[model samples]
Target: LIKEYLPGVSILFPYRLLKTEDPLPHSWDVTSDTIAAWVAKQTSALFIKATDVDGIFGEEKVIKNILASDFSEHFDSCIDPALPEFLQKNKMECIIINGKFPERVIQAVYGRPVHCTTVKGNI
Candidate 1:
């Protein structure tokens, strides 16, 4: 279906197993955020997580940008539990933005500045 509709674009379904080999975990820890990051790592594309919140929050403040090395040093919110570690390990960055506002999604896709949290890769 993807080849006929989206063409070159690729989409990963966390709930659906493509095959018996190397399947993702069927646990809550693996949400769409982590799934997207995993897909990005596989496709060599950027990963962006659109959530209801503006971004990740810790200590009552929104962390705008952070490196993967320091990603574990903060409170977890707005993303799946396994996302940060997976992204860091794969050297893949992830941008978390507000899905409530559709424009932010476009901004994130284009690498434009948006009110979001950028979890840096291991580079």
Candidate 2:
């Protein structure tokens, strides 16, 4: 069990019944929606998203920081389509880093600067 390994970590699996028939819930949609709802009721927390690449790319280079308002459908390949809108609407922010390197992930959790993309909705 996860608790056995990381006792301090709390894992939550959230699901909601949709009105649409036979529509499978998209994982990213669930994540974004769940975060939005939880953020409304809790203290602000850093959202770190791990992926294969270093971060979001633009013009063949990583975009260190970007505004949610500047996000477009073209970025759906890198993140969930619903996430940008959710961040902008909620005035939240998230950092994207490469999961391939565990050390970077650790650094991120510790609030240390790392080579990553920061999607800012808090602007």
| Highest lDDT model number | 1
Q: Which prediction has the highest TM-score against the true structure?
A: 1
Model 2 Cα lDDT, one tens digit per residue, 1-123: 112337676654333323332233456554553453344324466778888999988898889999988877665546676777677767777788999999999999898999999888755
Cα lDDT of model 1 overall? 0.74
lDDT score at residue 82, model 2, on the 0-100 scale:
71
Candidate 1 segments exceeding 4 Å error: 1-18, 23-27
TM-score of 2: 0.71
Cα lDDT listed for each candidate:
0.74, 0.69
lDDT per residue for candidate 1 within 1-123, as digits (tens), equals 123347677544544433433546667888777766776676687778878888878687778998766755355677777776787778778888888999999988887899998888686
The superposed Cα distance between candidate 1 and the true structure at residue 122, in angstroms, equals 1.0
* Residue 43, model 1, lDDT: 67
| TM-score for each predicted model, relative to the true structure | 0.76, 0.71
Backbone N/Cα/C clashes per model = 0, 0
